[model samples]
Target: MFLNNLFSKIFRNQNRIEYTTGKAVPLEEIYLSELEKYPIWIYALEEEDVEGQDEFWVKPITNSTNVEAELSTPYILLKIKENNCPVSALLDIENMKLDDLQYWDYKYGNWEELNKLDMPSPIHLISIPSILGKPAVEFSVDIKPKNQTTAIARTLMGPDECKDMYKTLPPNICPVCHTPLKREINPNFIVSNKRSCLRYTYDSFCIVTEDFKNFCTLNHYPNLEFKEFPKSPGNYYFTPLNIFPLDPIRQKIKFEECCSSCGGFKGAYGSSPGFKSKNFTLPSNDFIYRSDIEFGSEEKKSPLIMVGLETEIKMKKFGLKGIYFDDIYE
Candidate 1:
């Protein structure tokens, strides 16, 4: 974060060029009539994969998510051409809310649709680091972790392991994207390995902490069932008995190729930042829950793992690992 500033080369009646001078520059130093700089995170800016590189690319990071930037600094400003004019918006972390993003695609630019108003631009989303507040009431004031890291670990039920769950895609699958027009989980998931103790998984597969499970039990976290997986005590797996439909959008998530099934998608893409969707809906803040909407890929998919803010605060005392709560955009 304490690095050298960045500067952009200015060209008149031509395109604006940006470059770094081995130092970070103030947001004001790179002012332009045609462009505006926004704050974003430095965590993985250089490594992030924005699907439509041929059509659009990320704007220069004039304002990285250093300690001095916005409270939610983990973000990136994406630049795309709309009506032959440069336009951009912030792709925030965690909360995947693309409030003002436009004309997003997973493949090459679709110039014909640039002028279409209210067309939601697909972009990356992540949760920013946040400070926990006082709990409404403690879930278990007595329970605490010896060390956060050792207590929790991430888990993924990859392709081979999850294949039998859906041996074949439903017949009504989208012919273009190959997404099942109507699909559902196998419902029978056995938690095989239980030795992990506390698992905290994220991304398309929303695995949560088993420690938080214990903590939430006292406070009445519903639909949470921890059984023998890997044999010792607790693990993460999708259980239909515990799922409910809370993910807001009714449309299918896509990476590219405008299919009748998906909103906009082409190939394997990262999770959409649905925080900015006009029809965004969130699970109630009353309980730590799971979304009926499944995330991840056809090879391997998982549920939209979710936790309520209030419940998150209550879990704080347990000193849980690998868990953070981003405000759900309603």
Candidate 2:
């Protein structure tokens, strides 16, 4: 009878939805309001807390560098600093309704009435070490609804692709030096251990064939000399030539090289238009980091801000990476 009771208790616990308060809510027929009662718990990295410790909270996964949480229905993954570090509890959106959630709407393309809301004022500016070891500025924005307490944290500047200061330029002109760029010709070469009979240099890597040589001679520049392959094999192997522009400005060339077969370089690299200028204007200070709260009261809060110190560390990725606040859509 004791053994039977132990098995039954285990089964019951497995089926229960545990909250941070040591309370269990049935997994089925659970309402949004029930989950909101628990404070959004923030666990230290690798800290093992009891299930349901906070119904809507975040914690680091076991033996992993990522912090994960299910904010209502949306699953969030954050890349933060070192392991075992304390996580700050920044926001709580329990009383928020689905229609009033802007974070969810923006991500899922259900954007409606987004611009009608007032932008949240910046509460704090935290400088944290990004995955790239550069100091990344995080802005904490206060949420509204006078009665509900919620906030959001995001990077001061959004993704690099979304930045407004960077611009692209047209082709032919060297992206680095703004000078006329020319193609480089070679007799033979090996790239990635593969042999090529001929090569043409531009921003894009390309190889030319014998047919391409004939086509270029007849139709294109007929005066240009084309090298002929010897009928008898020789012990000659070609060294890769540095045809790339030496000028720092010329290195950013956006023009792609073309071959005779397809009239363009195959498997081309760095084909995207290079930046027009090398200098980048920093983000404006007037910019506000918006929050997810859409239809809440416009009540204002005192600017009680907090900022974290920057730490330098090695990372696995190249660009800046961090966790941003997101809302549950479902």
Candidate 3:
């Protein structure tokens, strides 16, 4: 059966690869209002390791990197540093909405009738990928309400509330340089799952298994296993769940390649377009660590599940690696 299916699949168009799951919602069904509230910004601090010049690092974070690739949606760059200040003119706009949303909350200070904006709005992480594309450590943000029917907000009424809408994180320091954490920081909303099972409720690990099973069953692959990887909080990206976990290790091997900045949990290794390496290596040490620790524990509070790796032997009759974001749409 697998061989028959594989041969028939050869003729399928790779343009849009269909998933085991059904199609996602229609474009019109989602709007800016339906997306997460705050935009998710990606801050990247980088040094080119050029010859001769003393290595100068951007303290905290700075806008010096270049954009590589973007997923989820796209937005524009608005160079304004003003956070809480009211956006008075249309030119004050920075980013635009790319996907649809269910609802949104907006707040604007003063100029009550003219400056106010609100509603169940769609949002976007506007300057994220572009900022990531720079040479300096840039602060990328996505401001929702990218698309609105009116400028005067109907949701989140009142002065203090309006001020809250523009609130920033790590307050008072330039989010990039510790000058001030401005209201301009990316805004986001929380998505909660109430399922009680460790595998279903607490962790998104099942996603890995489902993807693996689909590929193995359809492609007749072999020796496939899921491995855990690190998660990047700022990017809101987690490693695939449903992989094996290494037993805690004592007297673990240490390395000299540590970040000059924050040590321990805060240290850095290497980074790719979407992920940053953890300071320490996984005990499994195997290029691929495989495990399946289900979620469900009441102890978990973080929204992101630990990342994991997926591996299959070269001899495996079937199976594939690296699920593409575009695959979801296909």
The numbered model that scores best in lDDT is 1
Listed in order, each prediction's TM-score against the native is 0.34, 0.15, 0.18
User: Between which residue pairs do clashes occur in model 2?
Assistant: 18-52, 19-52, 19-53, 20-52, 20-53, 20-54, 176-249, 176-250, 177-249
Better of 1 and 3 by lDDT: 1
Ranking by lDDT: 1, 2, 3
lDDT (10s digit) by residue, model 2, range 23-123: 22211111222223331222221222442222222231222222122322211111112222111222222321111222212222211122223444423
C-alpha lDDT of residue 114 in model 3? 19
Per-residue error for 33 in candidate 3, Å, reads 14
The lDDT, on a scale of 0 to 1, for candidate 3 is: 0.22
TM-score leader: 1
Q: Candidate 1: where are CA atoms >4 Å away? A: 1-210, 238-272, 276-284
